[model samples]
Target: MRLIRISTNYPAYIQNFYGQRSALATQPYAQQYQTLMADCYSWADFWTQAFGKLGYEVWEPVGNAEPMQKMWAQENGVSYEPKTWLTDIVAAQVKQFQPDLVLVNDYATYSRSFFTHLRQICPSIRLVIGWCGAPYSGYENVFKAYDLVLSNIPSFVTDFRTQGHKCEHMHHAFNPAILKRIKQEQNTPIDFSFVGSIYRAHNFHNQREKLIKQLVAATDLRIWANMMQLSAAELKLLPLKQQVYDLVQLLKRLPLGQTVLPYLPKLKSYARMTNRPGLEQYVDPTIVARAAPAVFGLAMYQTLADSKMALNNHIDISKSYASNMRLYEATGVGTCLLTDGQDNLADIFEPDREVVTYTSAAEAIEKVNYLLDHEPERQQIAIAGQQRTLNCHTFDHRARYLDQLIKKNLA
Candidate 1:
């Protein structure tokens, strides 16, 4: 069967590929930048590589140019309309490649009309599946355009199906080939580390801030924000806004601010900007000052491998279950995983044996300390976690599952 994988940053990948060869010869910094680019493209690269190994004729076309174009548009205060350029490119690829399936990892870039146009061009296309990383409340229309929708979150699958969409619970997996340990010296410097992006203040959902505050106070924790750039000027305003908000709250009890409290909504817009709240707020100032900038792709895996324990925290939206890529990536790299507790965690890893779970900030701190003290036990769990991931949760395992689902649907 023929398949065409649609990636959000294939254009950037292509540019980086050529750019690396020509510019990397003499520049020392070029190699580091190239590694970052590779990390950005690793998701799409994993699936393409996995399917190719299974003997499928996989063709990954640059389906969207947003990654390459967004920064320029943002800096100039302009908008990017994907439909203007993407539709023609995607239709042309469908017409020329005529693949049996078109798989999308980033569905937000493709509109309902774009898929309808692709269907018109190649009516023989068997299926179009999109992987969703979030809930489907506002995105039902987007999923309706696809024959199948896959999500790592189990609740999302149930929600999508209740809304009459064909959805499957496809859990996240690790690529052992991409994320293996490089030999490091016996002493790993970092005791505990957390690597992931912090959500914006507007979309705050998790208890990450609370956990980070406790951890920073208790242990030698390292945090790396997986963001492009965090503005120092914006961060400077947060405390002033927070102080004003606190004063306003204190005034509310005095009967004068109570009348003005209704107008607080108007002030909130300005207040939020000053607050600049997010994961940055909870992190200790010392840690934030010394924190290493974001690392991606191979460097991310290497970081996990070198750490004695890798911490995992799920966002608020993941309610009652853990569903983040870090669970697999950290454990797959043979690092002892210290993760938040979830009801379905045992379904993924045998907690306490393969992975360790924490219910509260105190527990997380206590476990981190205990695990750090007991090196042999921690190493045993890490080895077990890695073995379990290799046996049950690799990209090849997910690819095979997807292949079967496609064949069954086609048949």
Candidate 2:
């Protein structure tokens, strides 16, 4: 079987190609796109490599840069009609290659007209699959354009199926080739660290913000309470404060929370209670300054490998399930993971064995402290987690499952 994988960075690659052939090399946008293409390493790489291993001829066509360039110009306040160069190139490639299966990853930004044009050019294309990461909030119609939709979010799959579209639940997986154990020269320096973005309150990160604040408080209690010589009353107040914070967070998730949300902002003094501080307020400034800046690609693997323990916080959207990529990537690299508790976590990893889960910040702190003090036990769990990932959660495993599904359904 022949397969074609479409990547979001194809336009950047095309821009780089044209930039090299003309004076466009000197343009600022061309230079910027070139840098981005160089840094781009994503799921397309893993999927293509896996399909090739399965003895399928794979063709990856670079998209036309004209539309992307026009979009960039518009973003900079210069209006221009989008060119059809990308669609033309894609159509020509599809007509010539005659792929049995075409896969698109996060292709939401592409215009509907382009997809219609693609269908016109390649009428006999066996199947077109769309892989989605987010919910089907704005992209419901986009999913209809594909023959099948694959999503990590179960709710998204159900929603698509309800709309009479073929959708399947495919969990996030790790690429063992990219995310693997890296032997470090120096010993692990960080006792514990989280390597994900912390967004503002307006986004769906309120749960994360609260959890992080609670963790910060726990850290302070563990490291600074004795140093600062707190009184008995202060020590007693710490747990009480955490309990109250937990109660408030719980109430926010209840139906009563939704009912009060509309009116909560109207009350002046009560509105302040709903406000959540940014990451700076929760984390120690000194720790933040000393922490390594966000790393990507191969450097991320090294960072996880060098850390004694890596932290993971799921967004509020992934209700009842641990559906983030971090679950696989951290464990795949042989790092002892400490993640927020989810209902379906035991289904993925054995609690306190293959991986560790904590329901609250205080529990996370307690587990982290215990794991740090007991090195051998932590190492054993990390090794078990790594083995489990390699055996059941690698890209090769996911690819094989997808291959079977395609053959069974599309046949």
Candidate 3:
């Protein structure tokens, strides 16, 4: 039993975090890392902490945090160089800890060679678990290396299984400590609020963007997100992008295509984008301009906590499943959530009792107005949702399930 969990934070949060704590950068690597994880930024140290609590010896390293890794290398006497994170840094950590299990939250970034190096350096390693929530087209062979694959989306589970890999479905959970960290007043200020992304005009986010636009036009909704606008030229070529993506995927499945197809750039990126210079035609750029900048970490929790009702919409790729962090995050922080309706929603929440759901934007608008006008019912649902999340949907529960899953396989 020892385990190592690999996770990273958003580049925006990393930059902001270090900016706010300039002195922290000068501290020892251990001290800098301790301060960094104290904010509980993203899922950075969550799995390690959760598994450690259950008496499993676990270590979590922020995988993509290069500055921190460099510090670790300096402190541990591990040599560092450019583009050697896989060869030098991570391999050294594996060789030192000799963990039995390695869980990669951002699995697509690394290749099979990285895992091979780990296996070579640490023969004690038993499982290579990967967490993939989005559709990654270019990382086909990268995924084939995982010992077990996990996704919150049921469809993704099916996709992994169809690709002839071992996969399981799990729901993302909330950290209740967020409540203690971010205090909320009794009287909430905002009537309705939304905190999410609207990156591109096509794919799952396109549906979310469309719904957000309709809701914003119809209701008094305040929004926050980090969005990038696509150029007019890119917008015009979206259809062509879709065609290219389809053709690539189709060819990848063919017997002949398996031999000679090289991965091309922008193959299916237009399908789901959060960065700049992509699909922006989905939503009116004016709304993006008017939107408050995206919130993260504790600020995001405080934002949701202060809102009377927070809206959540799943991406189109979710495909009839309620699979996203917002469900637990919004509800865990004590806000009435009005998310898009999905089949497994009731499995997680009692709908109307714990959370409210809507099938269409028009319906969401109608519910938003009614919830705004009626205070007692909305607060009641919010309270219940928070209770459900605190009681059942937490990293502790997830850790226990993971413990069992890993043990069964080990047995």
Candidate 4:
């Protein structure tokens, strides 16, 4: 088996700044602190190299002009022209890699054009696959373009199949390396910790401040905004492009007090910004970049090693879907996670068994109290969740399953 996988946006470093158009842009404050980067790209690098072990060749488009960076930069006033467009470059990469299968992440707004160009170049490639999430609406058209579509949101798989498209449910997975990090750091203690975007929709910034004000008033609460790091002047004069070179320094966190004030006058507008509107052109690049795709890396480890219990509150937004890498990440790290229950969570673990759940602020506070009071039970739940992740949800498992799915679908 052979494959070419594509992702539109990923972090620059494990613990780097959020550049203007990147994830850092949305939550400028995250750049001020230490935020661990997710290792999805590392997963890509690992699995690609590991494919050789399975007697398959893999090629991924790497470097800056890689589709993700190029597309993101332009949208955020970072880069005007991407080094290469999807169709042309991918077609060339396919010819060079000579793979039997093609795997594409559902990042691009329009995937058909890319798939069509690829099929034109390599009609005998055997299979073309695209993994997707919600928004199965107009996707019936795109679904027909590929030989198969992998849906992480399994509930919608049957709907696509009904449209004469071959769709399958493939659950999300973690990387063992991250779990190892969790184990290594499980003993280290942190005060109060949270990892994710600070946008209004995801509510990373506001919720964090609220938590800090309440339970963590005296504790050391660290938020790794993971957005681009920038100076004071840059934050004030961003997107306007007043001084070209000076803005290049990059910035993340704005003073919490000052940042929220700007939003107070225009809470409605600011809230909408966090909600994520428009397409590649108008949408804030940082929202996509800084949110941390594999945000679970250090958070999981940190939650277990440093804190008594880690808080996982997803922003309530219309379009937002619970990424749940945090849920898996926290569990894998053996960190006691207290998250607002989301869709299909019970399928992953029993609410009070593998992980704990809460709906209201009072309940969340109560759960934290209960877990802290009962240390052994908390540890038991943590151990159970970690074992489950280690057994079934590592990135290695994801890659292996992906390989088999492609072969089976093609056959």
The candidate maximizing lDDT is: 3
User: Between 1 and 4, whose TM-score is larger?
Assistant: 1
Stretches of model 2 off by over 4 angstroms after superposition: 9-40, 59-96, 179-186, 201-203, 220-292
Q: Tell me, by TM-score, which candidate is best.
A: 3
| Candidate 1: tens digits of C-alpha lDDT, residues 236-331 | 876776677677656656777668766778665543454434444344454466467666556667788889999898877786887888988888
Computed on alpha carbons, the lDDT of every model, listed in order, comes to 0.72, 0.66, 0.82, 0.55
Every candidate's CA RMSD: 7.5, 11.5, 6.8, 11.8
lDDT of 4 at 72: 38
Count of steric clashes across candidates, in order: 0, 0, 1, 28
Stretches off by above 4 angstroms in model 4 are 11-43, 49-55, 63-87, 134-142, 158-164, 179-183, 198-222, 226-308, 313-323
Candidate 2: worst-modelled 10 consecutive residues by lDDT: 220-229
Q: Candidate 4's C-alpha lDDT?
A: 0.55
Structural similarity to truth (TM-score) of each candidate: 0.76, 0.69, 0.86, 0.63
Candidate order (TM-score): 3, 1, 2, 4
- Candidate 2, residue 278: the lDDT equals 23
State model 1's lDDT: 0.72
Candidate ordering by lDDT (highest first): 3, 1, 2, 4
Residues 1-411, candidate 2: write the lDDT tens digits.
888766554343445445545755445654544443433234535766677788888765435445444444544554433454455555656676778888877556655565676777777678888887654365666666788888887766777799898989887887877643355533676667676545433334557656665666566311111011233565567566555555556666799975775675543333335543223233333333334444554555666777778888776777567778878878988889998888878878888899888988778999998998999999899889989888888778888989988897787
Question: Cα lDDT of model 3 overall?
Answer: 0.82
